[model samples]
Target chain A: MRVAAVVKRIAKQFKRDRRSLALMMIAPLFVLTLVWLVLDGDDYEPKMGYSEMPQPVIELLDEETQHLEQYKKEEAIDLMKDGELDAFISIEGMTPTTLLEGSEPSVNSAVMRVIQESLKSLKTNTQIEEPTINYLYGSGDMNLFDRVGPVLIGFFVFFFVFILGGISFLRERTQGTLAKLLSTPIKRWELVTGYVAGFGLFTIIQSVVIVAFSIYVLDMYMVGNFVELLVVTILLAITALSLATLLSSFAKNEFQIMQFIPIVIIPQVFFAGIFNLETLDRWIQILSQFMPLTYGAEALQQMMIKGAHIYDVWFEIMILFGFALVFFILNIRVLKKHRSL
Target chain B: MSFINVKHVSHAFGKEKVLEDINLTIEEGKIFGLLGPSGAGKTTLVNMMVGILSPDQGEITIDSTKVPSFDLMNITGYMAQSDALYQELSAKENLEFMGSIYGLKKSELKERIQHVMKTVNLLPHLDKPVEQYSGGMKRRLSLAAALLHQPKLLILDEPTVGIDPVLRKEIWEEFRELQQQGITIIVTTHVMDEADKCDELGLLRDGQLMAKGSPGELKEQHHASSIEEVFLTVGGVES
Candidate 1:
């Protein structure tokens, strides 16, 4: 019953603070849209320049490169230096030598792909059949946004909930409401539980809106059940909320809560599978195991990209639950500083 | 035994002793004031009485029940030196939230909220968000919230600091009305005139209780004309 009052109060407060409400609900979607615009573009077609090349190779290269031009070797080198040409190819002693701008890794790979495709055709006299590709989960059309979309969703939910919950809890202490509350008959666990229940209600709605918008409106890749995805996201948010309120016990004000961003939130983003961690040092990869977002983002990726079932991600779900439970207990323990009972 | 007994209560924060060997008692149905300047440990002592803080050396009990107890908490209302209110919430919402924490039922909470708001003379602005309220109005709202649970003991820490003289007088009257109903009121203040209005006053200086008595008795004992003179005389002797 006491928890209900706290939840109702939080709901009423959220209604009054429209700006924070909009920030939680709409800001992530807005940022995700920007990321999609930047990441979900068509594959790059490198600009290629050739001088004294065979007609057969030129025809093949022409088919691969979107912007192709024939120029003198000096002209091609000048264009490459000016960043106009991605690569320049010329025949040197019957073997084609290529000079690349070599500044951008993505552009470098694109230029290599066009040159390799054209050269491979030239090496084989007989016509080669194109290999048919098949995907177990995502299709060939999957873009960078599709791959990172689930991790970003988990990250934003964790980030926003941490800030909002931490500050609100800290405000309770700084404003003296917490002292007033400690003077009341309410139990310490009830207060902590009330906070979780209160913020949990809002995070559920936030997760639903963000996940649905990402998959349906933003056209993110989703092969798993929508409801399963929400379960992971909501669990991630609750973990974030509990951790935030627990940390707020140490902070004196909102600015101190912000100090947690670089130390707490940003590191989780890097370690939460937003970037591939396979090639990183073993200890760095082990560090990801300690972060709650790592499990959440991993579960979300398994579900969205690999079409994993609920049971497949149950371990992640249990770990997220354990993190939240530890934080919730620590919150109750911290309240003992104000009131022993 | 008196209704409230604070026995040998001494509390310190790190090396700075905030309250030293403070011993006092108050009977039921009376207004007792702790008079002190800022950092006199009036708030620290008040917090112990309200069960928010525990004394380092001794214990406090109300009506024979040791404090920091939930049962005692149910009957004690506390208003801190700072107005502890949610700025985004309306006056009604703030009261309702506090009332529910005491486990007040829906109908009773609604009725009690109305009664307290009316007592504070803030009924008309009950729906206005506290952010729009002036400092005095917020202070009154905090008082109203403390009174909503109908606690048997009310501990108010400088409750009238931001209020104007007229409202302050009215609030004192309200305190008296509650006192008439057998509720014990403990008010801490530095205002001399307000100290005189208390049924009994305890003069605190530098973390020690310098004197404790009724206003008239204190004046007569010290051969002083006013409560301020009595305070100065008591403090003078101690220093």
Candidate 2:
């Protein structure tokens, strides 16, 4: 009943702030939708200049990127130097060398992707030896969104839940109600548990809406059990909710809560399996173990992409629960600053 | 005999002692006021008395029993410096919540809610969310909530802050009326006029208790015309 009172009160408070409700429910879906569009772009048109081209090679280029007329090698080199061109193709003899004036890594990868895909498709049509395609979770058609969707799902649930839960608890300090609650008979852990249970209820709904939207509307990959996806998402929510309230003790206001996003949340983005962690420095990779999102990401990908059963990813579930437990305990300890009891 | 006892209570946050060598006793059925300015540690002392905060080097006993107990919590009502009402909820909902937490049943809860609302004169705006209420109205609602359980002891931290003078008087009258019914009200205030109204007052400055007595007794002792001058003289805080 006491927890109910806490739940009812927080729900009532959240109900009044339409902006927060919208941010929790709709913002995740909106971002996923944008990712769906940008990453799912079927054909990536890359700008290319030809230095010298064989008739067969010139025909191999896609209409979208083929600039085949006068194969002026010097002029093409100058354009690349001035950043006017993404890359240039030169066929001195039989083997073709791609001279790319690449500055940005992502742009370089993107250009490489388009050129390779076009070249392979063209080679297949010409009855030449075609490049072999092998996929683990997705085929060649799978875009970056599908690849990163698990991490994104884990990220958003962790992010919005953190911000919302942090700000809501922070408002208690801002609004002066936390001191009032401390004066009550409610024990410190009861306050922490009641908060976890209360916000946990709201987060369940937010997770459901956001996850369902990402899967159905954005059509992000989900090869695992729907129930497992829900499990990972809800666990991520618990971590977010607990970590937010715990860190909130250190923050004086909402802006300070936002400050945690970069220091606490953003680092997880790189380590949450959105990119290849193997390529990163070993120490940077170890930092992922500390982030709550890392476990959530691993669990989500295991379920959604690998189709691993609940038992297979049970360790991840336990780690996520551990993060939540530690955060919850820290939350109780932080209250000592307000009241020793 | 003392109804509430604090002995050699010293507290600090790290190196900075917020309350030091504090010894006090409160008589039963009395209107006791702790008067101190902001940062004078009035809140720190009250928190210890309520058992929310424990003294680092001492103890608090309420009604001859060691404090920070569930038994004490049920018997004592606390209204903190902050309003502590759920602003998204109606005043009535907030009262119901506070009442329920204190273990009040439905019939008694309803009766007490109405009585306290009327006591604080928030009965008219009982259904409106606290966010819509003015500052004074919110203060009144908080007072109403603190009165819901009919606890024998009531501890209020800055209870009349942000309250209009007219409504503050009415609330003080209610405190007196409750005191007549044998409720011990421990109120903290920085206002001189409010301090003068208490049956007994303690003047605190810089975490030290300067003096404690009935208003007239302190004034007579200090040979001062007003409680403020008596306080200033005792605290050595003239100006």
lDDT of 2 at B229: 92
Expressed as tens digits, the lDDT of each residue in A1-341 for candidate 1 is 88888889988999999998998999999998999899999989889999888788899998888889998988988988888899999989978899899999999999888888888867676777878999888999999999999999999999999999999999999999999999999888888888888888999999999999999998999999999998999899999999999999889889999999999999899988988999899998999999999999999999999999889989999999999999989989988888877
Give interface RMSD (Å), model 1.
Answer: 0.7
- True-contact fraction for model 1? 0.86
Model 2 chain A: worst 10 consecutive residues (lDDT sum): A62-71
Best by lDDT: 1
Q: Which ten residues in a row have the lowest lDDT in candidate 1 chain A?
A: A121-130
Cα lDDT for residue A14, model 2? 75
- Residues B28-81 of candidate 1: C-alpha lDDT, one tens digit per residue: 888999998999999999999998887899999899999899998899999998
Candidate topping DockQ: 1
The Cα local distance difference test for each model comes to 0.92, 0.83
Q: Across residues A1-341, which tens digit of lDDT does each residue of candidate 2 receive?
A: 67777777777767787898999989988888887887887654556777555555455564656343444778878877887777787766777678777787776776677567555644545766646888776666667787789899889988999999998898887777787677677788887888888888878898889888888887887788887788888889989998899888889888999999889988888777899899889998888888888888888888877788879999999999998889889999999877777
List ranges where model 1 is wrong by over 4 Å.
Answer: A126-128, B237-239
Q: What is the TM-score of chain B alone in each candidate?
A: 0.98, 0.97
